[model samples]
Target: MILSKRSLLATATAFALVLPAGWAIAKEQLDVVATTGMIGDAAREVGGDLVKVRALMGPGVDPHAYRQTRSDIVGMAKADLVLWHGLYLEAQMEDFLNELSESGNVVAVAESLPRNLLIGHEDYEGKFDPHVWMNPNLWSRVVLNVRDALIEVQPESEATFRANADAHLEELRELARYTTEVLSSVPAESRVLISAHDAFNYFGNAYGFEVMGIQGISTESEAGLQRIAEMVDTIVRRDIRAVFVESSVSDRNIRALIEGAAAEGHEVTIGGTLFSDAMGAAGTYEGTYLGMIDHNATVISRALGGDAPERGMSELLN
Candidate 1:
């Protein structure tokens, strides 16, 4: 019981070697290390019992500024498959991820989307917005990326992968319809969504809303004095009632926007927190990709005076 560390390790190693065949058999699950929870969820949904998934960036962790921890690097090194959003979503870790491809199956799932479907980044040259998950229809395309990535790691599970992906896509189809039906109920002119950053362009395009953000696309890009001043002017001039904040981003910039609008006699209030770069708390209904979209659609519909169930598409489901 008081064995030295080295002796304990040696004893455990011997025990492992002497274990019964079934007990000694390794679990046949691909070790998947995904950078984002959205990707991680897809891996779990598609891979099912065939993959053990881990997400590097959890709820409220901004991927735009996230640098890999030593544990993340070690996990990725040991993983059978690796997935990231790409499209410059992980701006800070691009080089590191690129280098990983040389040694393993590191793939950028969203980057595989056709350029035509992507919104070009307004400020950055030759870059596209990475928040494709905002639109359930477009997100279906990314699901295929997850499917293919899983298949690549475990070719024998192709049937399972395809079946799970098809099911997920069908759910997305329902989600898209629900989003359209709910968001369309809002008065057309009252459809402007002001938020912490320019992360909702895809959501706006998919749902027909004019989106404005205090900062540019990447949260890494800071909002300057003039930018805040300009936004305050826009809010007052337009008489926008509700601005939203992002779950992964700081509310400091949004608070400034609120203060500035108040100073100008505009009563803009924080609408609701939306999931942007990250999903919601794990194990909650909002944690899943489906739940995340449903929550946003329901919240946006309610806050903007649209007709939607308060609990979402189905009161029983969420």
Candidate 2:
């Protein structure tokens, strides 16, 4: 039977609405753009062959003060979804990323965690620390966030995404176990960790180190002379032998720390570079999220007189 023209138009409209989302999912891979290496790693793992992932920040890149370039704006604009750390971690780029949510899916995975589980920022009123990845257990939540985001975009790949997330979560658990074992080996007295920035409060909470960064949590804040002097005095008094420099952060303040301690008759050396704001070189084991944390935990352990493999707990980090 021939349908009326109005009925045909209405039928076509309903079909168009119903089929476009599925057709798009089948025709194009999800394009996911992430702000930091950690979130980028998650998208890559969870999306697998179903998505194309680009990370805006890379090795030795500081997310705290990172500003999006023209290329970054283009990438985010073209992406199916955007992932970021949030919790003011990307302080400089927060406003832009926040505004993007009005038009598309923009997720702040670290900020998705329960408030009570997050540590309060000492000075950033009403904000919580954004370094939740320091603790593998805490990072597991982020992995699931990535999985859910990917599934939202392309539901057909749900099984693959879930499986990849589960495997990655297990790896995170293993990394945590290794971190605990190695860090626990450090003598309790030598467990105070000093660094250029206060990025490891979560690490200290998870692994029993007394953490101090020369600069505050956000690198945008300056390390005052008084703060440096106080840290130097603490190092001298405790004879803390190792201080870590972060790959993304400037080492000038770290040098000041060492010089200050030396003038006071204490010798403190940089233990090893840690991947705080970013991962290691791309295509290397340290470039991955697992490797970043592994490298940091191993470096901190071996630096402070603990026993751990030179390469890392897995002997695969580069």
Candidate 3:
């Protein structure tokens, strides 16, 4: 028999209320449900052997428009901890997650970041950009929050979580260093980044590039013909040679930009397919948060006439 989402949530809440006080302690590994691959990677890194993490959104999945399914609700309800990137990244899941938070161990990991460090959303007043994972230095703060969350749920594993988080943060620091070096190598005039969407604003801010996206911060927003014409004009006027596509967002707009440029007698090539709102396939290195950023930095640097190793930082990119 099938049940409605509301009914399932109600049932899940009632079941939780009946469980013993130390019910989670009975389980060997903490079951963690994360809204995105980035959060899931953090949970796995910090929780290590003590956690079994499930990322609701996988490779090529756009969180901006992703709504919670019945299975997602059930999994999040039963999870020992639910980590979501707040700041409206999960646009469709916010209401459901807020409802679940009242009865479950739900936390918006990205919301823990200081507002001063966040980029303001142009279309929405008082809303900040949700893609903090783009900057390693900023993401280090999110890693701390993940560590604190893990410690809050399982105090006994505080030492382990702290250790793992520190190790992971060190790797992020190295990534920041490598990205800085490579991205800085691009000529100042050639550092403009045009992509399928506004997901790279943080990356642009970090590396001093002028970023333009065909779509807004949210993929749900449509890109009109005038916007395409304006971008084509910008590309031709600036003599921009490359533009990028995202793994999750459709490359149709990018293709439009290319065609538009060609019509204007300017040639442009696809810089690379970047993992913007999503990571690579699950089993690949690019699937990890570290690998995702590494691949982006390497590809952008190389495509924009900067210096970056073909294999990316740590020589681990595939």
Candidate 4:
């Protein structure tokens, strides 16, 4: 059949218009960058298939002393939206986060929490401790902030993000209740939590445990001979049973405490490994924030004379 060039062009245009919107072109997925695994996990739950999320610090990496590499800088620069835990959690990356916020793509999730509710660092006047996520109830607020940020970045997907966030928040609440119930099995006198580092103040506050760390709040702080001596003295004097080692920091300091106690005829065993600064490997239950907390709660409860389930699952402890 013979056809004029103008008629052919018109037919092609009509066919293009009749195609599905997806066939026309798929929308570009939003690029999301989160500071840590916990934030990344929350973002993933909220974003689902609508966004690409990248966590700057992975499992077992400490954020307090984490220096951003060149790739991290580039990633932050390229990200469409960024979520970071503020309240001095990222002390080294503060400037970068503030710059990103000025550029209008960064959101500090912890900023949503009210100041009066936060625990203040003793040495740092007027600065609140940044470990708000230790409480799932407080963490829900951060998750909601992440959802709002995602909606702001891609308003069309607001409903999906909101729904996902609601579901995830419910899970967090349940986990919190579970943690409380599990911890209740421990006798009040035995509820002492000692670790190599003092990262669990918020956890202690939430769970009613007396927390003592060999090191200070920030891992960057040094553990001197006096600090070790003090902790060892406490261990011997109180006859404490178990001390924990954090995955991110070196266990040498903790081992020294144990040896010092042994010299004084006090026996202390490591309770179990705790995920303080980071999560477990991906795909493992410990990789998720809830799983990490559940593992710690179970291990701690059992080690401290509580009736928590062994192995944390159906199988025996590995």
CA lDDT of each prediction against the hidden true structure? 0.86, 0.84, 0.89, 0.81
What ranges in model 4 sit over 4 Å off?
A: 1-27, 313-318
Higher-ranked by lDDT: 1 or 2: 1
**Residue by residue across 50-127, what tens digits does model 3's lDDT show?**
998888899999999998865676677788999999999998888888877877788999997888899998767889
Clashes of 4: 0
Distance (Å) between predicted and true CA of 27, model 2? 6.2
In the range 262-286, model 1's lDDT, one tens digit per residue, is 9887899888999998999999979
What is the model-wide C-alpha lDDT for candidate 1? 0.86
lDDT per residue, candidate 2, 126-203, as tens digits?
898888989999989988998998888778888999998888888888888889999999999889988888899999
Model 2 lDDT at residue 78: 53
Alpha-carbon TM-score of each model against the true structure: 0.90, 0.90, 0.92, 0.88
lDDT of 4 by residue, 133-231 (tens): 777788888899999999988898989999999899888887888788778888998899988787888889888999988877778778999989989
Please give the lDDT score at residue 285 for candidate 3. Answer: 82
Q: In lDDT terms, which candidate is top?
A: 3
- List ranges where model 3 is wrong by over 4 Å: 1-8, 11-26, 316-318
